[model samples]
Target: MKIYSKLTSLFIVVVLLGTLSMRPSEKKILIFFETKGYYHESIPTGVAAIQLMGQQNGFAVDTSRTSEIFTDEKLSIYDAVLFMSTTKDVLNEEEQNAFKRFIQKGKGFVGIHAATDTEYEWPWFNQLVGAYFKSHPKQQDAVLHIKDSKHPATKHLPKTWKRWDEWYNFKDIQPDLKVLITLDESSYTGGENGSNHPISWYHSFDGGRAFYTGLGHTHEAYSDPLFLKHVLGGINYAMGKK
Candidate 1:
């Protein structure tokens, strides 16, 4: 009877160890969507989509609508921070500083859609996000030219991808950005950036990594598997997984 009990205990221990070994290291992401200007109704959809991506990809995701979680302690637990359609002055001076410190420590940041329309007064943030939103035409169909198909964020995309979204014309464009995608001004109206209009980019900034994509303006974009995969690739790149 004692031998039977010992055998059962040993079997349980072996199963436990096997389970532990099969588990991968967990990575976490924080989605911040505090909006001080035009708030996209699609924010909730975007958040839910990211949560789904995390679940399917074996990562963890958390969402926030306030700047309270910018502290070193709170931000420490996250592998990346993503600004999901955040607009205009979302963070206070203190929170900005905290975020700067967090990035200086080699953390990651991903920006989507209106993230460029935010923090106009903060030059550092403009550079961090890669560009400032100058203007955009009405939501219409346009062709996006994928500049670097080798990038994980753009690899799945076609050489010429046509889509309907609010196309932005940017100002204060950073010269050092690795542009992954560009807009074909001939394909749409109100394209003020002229021929070489960059739409998505990534770079290393102040000891951290940064990626931005100008997609995700519509609710349908959140439900798109291709768009979601693009965003996930950006997240993975920011998290140093790519």
Candidate 2:
């Protein structure tokens, strides 16, 4: 009986050791970059940057330009979905409905650049994106005022961040959004919203997390350490890990 007990203890110890050696399951993110309107030349750069971030950060990333992957079955495998400069009405009604269901199931969403220019006819999508892109003057330099430094997205940024990108004017801005960064209108040309213009924000909506950033029009934005950190933080926040 003593020998049997010793063997059992040894087996248990070996099992524990093996369990400790195994890695935790990695979180997965889907990067959807379909554009029915204006396509961004920076999309490939954005995707590559995100892939690098995932490789370094232990998350997995999958990119898609087709809306067929928006089905709940496919989307369920991802912890979060990122709209990387998606524009115009990219998804069909069925795909849109599936995406809506995915969010309602407490998944996550991260919108970069022209994601606001997507799904104009879908009110739910509009609210999910937080606002719609009205127009932009041109790609230029602007100063971003950190509104909520406590947020994971803006916390790494200085109080005043200067960068060059295409700045967008927004319409139907959601009143309940937790603004993380605002545009300093005086620092740039073609300001429309004046002092109240939000450049980045995050909020909990419809049983899920949503984060949006108006930056990333320029390829260089993806390569900048500060901007990459900012985007990674937003991704983390949306994944509910921040």
Q: Best lDDT goes to which candidate?
A: 1
List of clashing residue pairs for candidate 1: none
lDDT of the structure predicted as candidate 1: 0.93
Badly placed stretches (over 4 Å) of model 2 are 1-24
**lDDT per residue (tens digit) for residues 109-191 in model 2:** 99999999999999999899899999998788899899898888888889999989999999999998999999999999998
lDDT of 1 by residue, 1-242 (tens): 99999999999999999999998678899999999999999999999999999999988999999989988899999888999999999888988998999889888999999999999999999989999999888999999999999888999999999999999999999999999999999999999998899999999999999999999999999988788999999999998884
- Model 2 TM-score, 2 decimals: 0.92
C-alpha RMSD values across all candidates: 1.7, 2.8
Evaluate all candidate structures by whole-model CA lDDT and list the values in order: 0.93, 0.92
